[model samples]
Target: MIGSILGDIAGSVYEFHNIKTKEFPFLTPQKGYTDDSILTLATADWLLHGGDCATYYFRYATRYPCPLGGFGGRFREWLRQGQQTGQLRPYGSCGNGSAMRVGPVGWAFRTEEETLKAARISAACTHNHPEGIKGAQATALCIFLARDGKSKEDIKNTVEAKFDYDLNFTCDGIRDTYQWDATCQGTVPQAIRAFLDGTDFEDCIRTAISLGGDSDTLACITGSIAEAFYGIPPALHAQAMHYLPTHFQQIVAEFEEKYGPKIH
Candidate 1:
């Protein structure tokens, strides 16, 4: 979870800048988390307290709303409506929203099946589209594999075979051809590849942010994978924790205590 938060914070400023190299400032004082971190913390909070999905999303979203440069218009409106009515019906959002916020599901479950189940539940709370749901599931599964010390080839093969996504894009290619894409299909695979090419956790995030498309979400996805592989460094983890509100910190700590450290 801290990995995801750190990624969001580190990538926040670069969302529109679209840099294509990994040689940029990271974890600057000006950086802060976006809706990706908020929703991930919310999901972890819900899982910890046995809170229902709708209640978790409603409470957190109402508390945070959309920060200055956060979610799309429809999603912001959906959060408002869900808070007002205390109901969260499927809105069929195919945005990378589901993928960006699913790190906790990967960590909370012990096995691949459990990971997939948790991912489905987490995605269904907001993103009901099949592609959206599959993106979350694929990301969770990748995290699980990374946690288990699976090789990059294994993770790629499993995810590519299971999900209907084309994993042909290389990091070099992403660096060559860049655009600001926020959709699940457009961003998730590139983020995963960033992690695969990374030398360490921070490198993974740097790689993702450098890919230059939906920077925050790409970093979120890469961070989740990095957490499973190398774990969040203690200094970076502490720094990331400071970005959250007190309530969110408490919730994330509770989940961490219950599930053990985010990375072994």
Candidate 2:
């Protein structure tokens, strides 16, 4: 979804040079999309066309092999190994990458069961760890619930009860001490809390980035859910399109036309 890509681009610059404050510009033009955006597109493409999830991930990743932050170390090695072996399998990773790229699944499926199943399938390609699958399912289900007109408290309770992620903390509560964390357990809960704490679509992203840990991935997850809830502002959506490649934009447009949540 465009929301996910927008967050990736917006937070790309701050991933390494983290800014703890939320006063920064909402969108950054200097840095483009990253592995988060690329894999998200891969997920969308897989859902649109119908194919092996791993193949799409490999194809998109290889096509844009070097993104802003580059692929995570293990994913980079997975690419290397896949290139040589022509085969891909689960790596048992619990990284936040699984949750970051699961936006489309949330929209494409109608039921909670379907959404969770698709999320699991998408994540099992590489992030087959229990936490990895749980993260993706939690994120996708949030989007599903948001678009279904569920209240924030309902969404929070469902995620906490089902996924066992404690969403009781605020972003400010963790900001001062939160350091860089790339795992699903650390990142997904905070991203959800950011969405719960947000005032709107952009606010959710800023809050996620302001948490100052795995900025792009955090914001990417939050943005996906926020877009489902608040809907992206027309100007923000159009501005974000400029940062995506032609092919990526095309997929976003097509997917949105078919399955996008109604804008608020």
Candidate 3:
């Protein structure tokens, strides 16, 4: 989860001012965490309560409305509707929002089936579109596989076969032409590619940001997988934790305590 938060904070600044290279600073004075981390912690909170994710997701967004990590237009509207009317309906979006909050599902479940099922249930709250659901499931599966000690090649092949995403494009190849697309189909594979190609956790984030699409979402998804494959450094983890509010940090700690290897 810190991995996902760090990636969100790292890429939030670059979401618009894309640098297109992996040579940027490793961030100083971390930007406030965005919808990504907020929703992720929300998902963890939902898991702690053993209920549907959408309830807590909207709850957290309304409670912690940070403008720094901007929400998508549709998602903003969804939150507004829920807050005003207290009635919820799926927005029929295939956005990467589903994938951004899915890291906890990967960590909390033990089996591939459990991970995929939980991912689908969580995603159905908002990203019920098939591509949206696929993105969340694929990401959770990747994290699960990596934590389960599957080889990168094995992970890559399995994800490709299961999700049918074109994993052939390299970040360097896509960096020049990638546009700001939020759809899961547009975002997830590239994020996964960054993780697949990276040499380490930091490299995975740099690769995702360098792709220059939806920077925070791309890096957030990549960072979760990177954390599973290459555990976050303690200092780096502490730094990201420092950027979050105390309550959010406590949720992360509690989630890990209940469902983590704690220190891989």
TM-score of each: 0.95, 0.98, 0.97
Model 2, 1-264: lDDT tens digits are 778887888899999999998889887668788999999999999999998999999999999988988889999899899999999988999999999999999999879999999999999999999999999999999999998999999999999999999999998898999999899998999999999999988888999999897999999999999998999888888888888889988999899988964455
CA RMSD per model (angstroms): 1.6, 0.8, 1.2
Model 3 Cα lDDT, one tens digit per residue, 94-123 = 999999899988998889999999999999
lDDT of each: 0.83, 0.92, 0.88
- Evaluate model 1: give its lDDT: 0.83
Candidate 2 residue pairs in clash (backbone atoms < 3 Å): none
The candidates, ranked best first by TM-score, are 2, 3, 1
Instruction: Enumerate clash totals for all models, in the order shown.
Output: 0, 0, 0
lDDT of 1 by residue, 11-80 (tens): 9988877778899888777788888888888889878877677677777777887663666776777877
Sort every candidate by lDDT, greatest first: 2, 3, 1
